[model samples]
Target: MTTAPPISPRLLKGALIGVDLFNPLASIIVFQYNPDTMTRRLEPRSMTGADGDRGEAYRLSGAPKETITLSVEIDAADQLADVNPVAVASGVGPSLAALEMLLYPKSLAVIANAAIAAVGGIEILPTSGPMVLFVWGPSRVLPVRVGAMTITEDAFDTLLNPTRAKVELTLHVMSYNDLALTSPGNALFTVHQITKEVLATANIFNSAQNLGTALQL
Candidate 1:
């Protein structure tokens, strides 16, 4: 039996080269222009319960949400000069066409008929539909759905096609525990567990050391 490759997000985060975002479906990369910075956030569900003696239940009002925001640049000057294979095959340079390919899959409306057929044929819908990955390092390869994208076209060719762009992309992370028990998801889930354990252990160690110092033990 072949063991699944470990999902390591930490490896990506430590590199000075910066993070990479990619669409597994489109098979296109945005490594040419790395983002200036990336922001990660967690939106916890609001707490709610009955008033008075009824103690508030400490649980997520709903599933917690994670979001990542970043701005990436796309410039096709190299493609325009030397004929990039991707640009040539895409029939356009690194302008709107490339951006569209990178982003469209996220919002593409599912064909209901095709989806129905797929379920009937496979007995279950695939969990990996047009998902994008925010690869930071080894254990930090996060799967996310594109939440929003803003495109600013700064330059264009003579014919009015875009040449340079600044794209602000926001991604909503897919919570690991909710994903199907598949390859990357499974590996990612293992990483998540390891991270939790490490954090807990560190906290315990720190607390014990502090207590020992206070008591002069």
Candidate 2:
């Protein structure tokens, strides 16, 4: 009898996808490697006491404010070892640039705004970048804004291109209150919260079953 080889489990990679607010299919950027660890913090939006109203003590204003922090690692060593042309030339510079661009306003938009200002246009609205979605897993996809980032380049090539780097990113989760009612982000957040509620219900059912078994009820 021939023995079959064991199959390895497939793992999904987390990613930060950028979609144009006006054109959804515009652009996307996937992380090179998944972060080893992630930290999340939540602050509840409690409407406890407004003008000493004790009746509203248990009321909530909206969804809790959430913040996530992760450190992404980028390395060009493997690709360079394989003699990849792009890696040989840029040495991870392009990857770094892609992440950095998420925080920048488009140059064209900047130039257009400058022209409008010169021509005496009043109240040129601030430009908005693409909508960023942080996808950790199927159930954990969230619309988020990049609050801050710190990049540390550990290794560099002879051409001064970064060969290896670590980027610490702080992301602020956007809730329904932060987005317009008709916006895609608002819809996503609503679905995310619904999913959480479903999971919580399932947990309650399982716990109740265990309790019944223990009590012989």
Candidate 3:
């Protein structure tokens, strides 16, 4: 019935926590993963009696994996002791800890959005011309262009999965929002084309940055 508490926020060293298309994080050549606690279930089995009669079997549920977030496991019940309460004590108050935790999701969202834009653009128009490069991140939206808009597909994919196994990414492009506007002498960029391009290039850059940082580290 006992379980371990979840680990606190720890800054990933050398490599920045990126909101790329992956999450185990691309900078990881390998990691000593401490798996979340797991439980084993025990249930009764039905059998036929010597009198040629059988009994119905009942099902049982096992212990649960402790949840850290709504969809994630913090870890098992046993790993907390070695984790250093003194180190975690600094974050217990409602000041810095609460503030940082509140900001975490938004930070993730910003990075996720930006990565999506950068990746999508680079993937579709890796040529360094005519196309727009948009980088969406937690703090700002930056535009990236390889001189023009010339981006190589190989380069983009390479950046996302550089080690071929760095799979922690979370890239996402913003969806199209249609708006009515006055035309500048009957201009011609269609909603479909723009949407397609933007989504295509969204996450490529962040993924690339992630991979680049990982490889460098």
Candidate 4:
């Protein structure tokens, strides 16, 4: 049987890019996602009795969530089409220019006249924050909020401008089990549910076949 290629996540603006994380408006692109290790977390709740040797058995409180840490390389030297044009300006090398572009999206910036409090009911300009998305292969594509990002500048040019950087991103997957069904945040939760069910069913069949019906109870 022939297998079909996996599909990448669609951005909020409708374009599809094969990246682990990206912010369309900010022009941040993570071309490759490295060390794909996922951590599944289960929150257990235990009951206690007034008089008992040990507390009551622990039960799973809710659906499990996952966390993944990715190591991504960001360079102004990379000449991919997705790289922002300003990063590859004339006179200055692409890599140094790229670093400038990279910093904008992740850095906290305030818009003009965007006061925390508005007087006389004047409309306040909303401050722009990082727009991040987390995609884990075809099985999981999620809209995620950034937890932590550490950028390491490993290389620089004669001008002392950072040309290459290694960005470490720790992201928290926003699950739908805790959100309203109508909300878009639940999309990944729905996908995770399907993946879990399918794997469970497959395991049962595989185990039964290996053990054989005659040996089964």
The candidate maximizing lDDT is 2
lDDT, residue 86, candidate 1: 58
- Deviation (Å) of 182 in candidate 3: 23
Better of 2 and 4 by TM-score: 2
Per residue, candidate 2 scores C-alpha lDDT tens digits across 5-80 of 9989888888888777554544465677888889999998988745758888788899999999999999999999
Best by TM-score: 2
Q: By TM-score, how accurate is candidate 4?
A: 0.58
TM-scores, all models, native as reference: 0.59, 0.91, 0.16, 0.58
Worst 10 residues of 2 by lDDT: 21-30
By the TM-score metric, which is better: model 1 or model 4?
1
RMSD of each: 10.2, 2.3, 26.3, 8.0
Task: Give the C-alpha miss distance for residue 151 in model 2, angstroms.
Answer: 0.5
Give the Cα RMSD of candidate 1: 10.2
C-alpha positional error of residue 19 in candidate 1 after TM-score superposition, expressed in Å:
18
lDDT head-to-head 1 vs 2, winner: 2
Instruction: Order the candidates by TM-score, highest first.
Output: 2, 1, 4, 3
Residue 118 of model 1, lDDT score: 69
Residue 102 of model 3 has an lDDT of 17
Error of 3 at 154 (Å): 46
**Which of candidates 2 and 3 is the stronger one according to lDDT?**
2
lDDT of 2: 0.88
Alpha-carbon local distance difference test for all models: 0.60, 0.88, 0.29, 0.52
lDDT of 1 by residue, 44-133 (tens): 765764552335556555446778888877777778778766544442344455445544433323455466776775454433344456
